[model samples]
Target chain A: MHYWRDGILALPTTSHYLQLVILWSIPINFLTKSYEFMLSAKKIIKCLDDHWPVLETLVGRSTLGSFSFQDVQALIQRHSPGFSSEQVFREAQRLLHHEVLIPLAKSSQLELNRAVLEFIQFLTQEHQLGTVGDIQSRIEDLDRLRGKLKAAADTKDVSEMRRFIRLMDERVREVVKHFRKNESAIMHLVEKAKADDTKLSLAKRYSAVMEAFDEYIEPVLQMIDINAPFQHSMQALEHQLSELILNIEQTGFLQSEKEPLVQLRTRLLDMNQIGREALIRSTDVLMPLREELRKNTLISRNASALLAHLRKKGLEPTLEQLVPKFSSDHQKFSLGSANQITSYMAELVDFQDEAYQMPEQVDPGDNANIRVPDLAEVLKSARVQKANTDLSKWLAKSYPQLPVDELLFLYQELSRAPTLKLQHLEQYSTLEVNGYRLTLHPFVPTATSGT
Target chain B: MQIELEQLTQLAEIHKKLSTGYHVSEQDFALWQELDTNEEAYSALFTALGNQLKRDSRGYFHFDVDDATVNMGKISRLFALTTYALVEFFADQGQDPLRALFEVEISHEILASILQQQYHLFEQLEVFSATDLKREVMNRMLRYGFAKAQGEHFKLLSPVYRYLDALMAVDQLAEFPGESSTSSFTSNQEQADV
Candidate 1:
């Protein structure tokens, strides 16, 4: 696993050399021609009676470079029926040491060594997603490459310029590649979080959402933050590259570098956009869950507060204090039902005591001289006074000349007294006051009472 | 408050929906969108209506008014109880209450488990079984447009942040248990009672 991880990362570092070593390792036994490699292989070969054929047959039996040791005995029996179980066990140990069959972290799983597995995956072009390094690294790499490109340009060495362009192209490809790989990895994390294969508690399920945010979202998002150093550096790199393109085109010697330079710059700028896009897409998936988490916590916290309230004041007070009354509309407490009434209760209802006798009534009237006018008389008096203005004639004369509300206000002023007997107008007319609509009416003057 | 008849035509549906406690989210697109695009118009419209339109950062729009109706108080209490009890249950399970509650669907079984873990805290809710409890909680959530029922499970909606705001207040007050939650609940609601 260590070798594979190192080897995968080291692919860019020593590709010219590994291109040859990888070709040799496939046909030949795990030979780095290093002593360690030869020793491990020799160990396996020594354990087997005829190791080459058995190893080759075992490798062939496994498809996709992944074979389960679900039945190690069955595999051995099927491959070499004549071989003893004891012999197979010893040989298997040797094969494991040689990494002919690398052990999976999970038991009952074994796969071809990383070299072979990666090779198969490569040959099949079926790469899965995982973390691609952040744009920060790419930005940092560009800073270094910019110096190199400048040097190659200053030297006027066409071959060196070509070499730098190729290298820059590869670096950008790695960035884009990682962008896609992390895309899948993040998606896988999302799926794992979303999947209900196990009844992991809600808290357990959220572990995946947190993992996506912690491991994938935050770091990448920080790298590409619009004003962050990564973005500024990326913009600087883009500018430098565009300038390089113009210089290349103007220098007129390294015409070959321009196209790739343009491509590099395009990919360079797109790197930030795509990185942002991929993360946003992933975040979009997580947002609902994220929001849910937020809301639920809020609820739980409120519940805690209420519970605290409950503890302090007891249930009745706590409940009475809760907002919006009943949490659910379902808890409607009905008034007592008639069906519950009984004859015994009816006795209580029917039994009534006589009223206490009152003292002799006396009429105390007219001595104080506080003669209160009857409401009807006062209303009639007010109406007669209000009848002084004819609202119908006033509105007909003034409505077209004034805004309706003003006209109504003027009419209201002209007929404040109720004795004027204002009525809704017969025509299609209305007035708005305090957001309420009222039908228009002309004042019909009644007889005056006091005046 | 010079609400043009045209603007009134645009806002009529929004008024009805908001009155019913439904959030006029950006997704609503038609009714409240005018208010969303025009903050001044929203303010004017709501101001004329004697209520304030509050937009939570979470994308749903609701009203914030101090009518403090009886029904609203009851709902707040229910939210208070549910949120607190849920946190307690999640804590018991060694899970982050907030994250898990949102991320995982609270099915009847899970609801049952939560209720079963501690019934007394939820006793005031007057629910008999997990199913009844889930129904009550979800119905309230649905009525308030704070959650949507997905199949047999219910997921909380964003307006639930109102409760979260409450929870934070609770936490703050809890740290100083000397000060009762009731005092802070009102102040907290004033700040973010969406």
Candidate 2:
């Protein structure tokens, strides 16, 4: 446990580094010689700061295992161009001596120390996604340790119980740590996929995203499901731990044991929460990209393929009845449906010619009355009758047989006549003729009929 | 099944638009909202009227007819060809066909270029010039509510997805065997209401 504390004390910075040290400490007991040779945390931190560019390059190429010494020195010189060749060699050697870059057992190739690699990954937030199997195995290990802890508690082997409790704590921390790192890794993957301006097709660019979805998200989703094995195992572990705590409480034989069990319980609960939240965040970031890629692929693939088909088959036969149909106003072209025409004919059958209604012809009783008296004859009569007589009265007497309307028509005509010379009488004389009374200012004929 | 009178406020206008091959999308704000809110009721009502009223998930409504008249069929084929050509046209320009189809306006100048470039294809449809394309297809698209006029240009609406879906389906038909082309296309035709 003090060894674990020493791992925690190695880096006073981010909790992730602390977790990294704890992770490194798990195998520290057997590698004491390497641990003793390892540089102080401050010296390592300073070294990492000085050579961050080189370390970052390595992290970027972390997938490529074990670079040669020359490769490492060249990386150093590339990043620190001002460094002399001797300085680059010396720095590379210093990295090797500090155990920051561990050489392979027999091979000349050197890999970045596992712990340093993880630390750099944490600082850069560029994590490689770990499979769900990694967490599952650890959880299964926790279950196995849980059984061992129960056996130790029954046998009252306090030391074994303490050791199991420590291991369980380590396991829980690792699970939580993995959750955080995997989340950051997923975020990195998403950002990379989206901002990838390469000429790759939509499908190719989102290949990693699709892989992450299939490999990580789907499996983790099931693992963290409320009704799934992961939760059930966690519950069983929790129950076992809680029951042990209760036993310690009642029996009061192992008061020292109570605290570690309690801590383990709290950690287990925290691990579950962190796992769930990490899953949610990963899902949140990935879902939209996944959907966008799916839709884009579907549309573009279809469009391109359909265009090819149109080219090969020609437009008409290719599209044929495949074209989308609209609810067309096709009925407008037809004259009439049989039903409509039949209904119209039925209405016609009951129809009559709507009574021809010859306009009421009033019999023109006499055409002679309608005829106007000859204007010249009237004027001649006026001349013979002599001047100084009321012309209207004479004309009325001469056309006495004419209807009143006709008589008035002759009077108006004589008044306006250009052939006759007449005077306009100012005196009003009421003349009765044709059963109608006429009021008039009689005009007298002039003496001279000016030729 | 019981639709309240209030639920069908736009029923008359909607029916008139749909029956005449007009796709009512969200651009028709009031009517779209009315139908969206009371979709089930409206679907049931239209179904009772011997109409297959479909609401596309992309947010549009239209009536699905089994077969088109000769003239409308010719118009539809021309529309299909134009859309496929557009997809190829945009894709050739390194633009996403779907995004360009919806987001960018197809101006008369753009349409002229499209028509000129796809001359042989358009000739098959009796479309020789831009004006012919506009009169025969683009204007009809506007009239049918497949696109909305934006000044001298136009942008396709969600209903154009029907053609994209048709494009994909036809491609699949060509790619795979044993898939009933008629049933698949007609089902898409069912989806093609809008």
Model 2 chain B: weakest 10-residue lDDT segment is B176-185
Task: Give all candidates' CA lDDT scores.
Answer: 0.55, 0.72
Residue-wise C-alpha lDDT for candidate 1, range B19-49, written one tens digit per residue? 5566666545676467666667766777554
The model with the greatest lDDT is: 2
Cα lDDT tens digits, model 1, A1-451, are 0011121343333443443344335534543345434435445435444454444344334432345654444566667778787877765665666665666665667765545443433322222333325444665787787788888878887788778777776676656556644554444344334322335566665665665576567777777778877777777778888888888677786787788888778767665666666676667546645544433334443454445445333555645533332122222122222212332475678788989999987875443354433445544544544434445443444333344455455556545644444444455545544344557555545434323
DockQ numbers for every candidate?
Answer: 0.08, 0.15
Candidate 2 residues A1-451, lDDT tens each?
1012122343224445557676466436524454545457788778888888787776555454567889889999988899999999999998887777877788998877767776766665555677777788888899899899889989999899899999998888778777776776676565455433346776676667777788788998988888998888899999999998998899898999899889789878867876776787677657756765233344554554554445334677777768888757764345453323555776788888765778988977674555577877876666566534676677777766778877787788877776567777778988998677888788766656532
Local error of candidate 2 at residue A99 (angstroms): 3.2
What is the DockQ score, from 0 to 1, of model 1? 0.08
Task: For each candidate in turn, give its C-alpha RMSD to the true structure in angstroms.
Answer: 29.6, 25.3
Compute the lDDT of residue A420 as modeled in candidate 1: 47
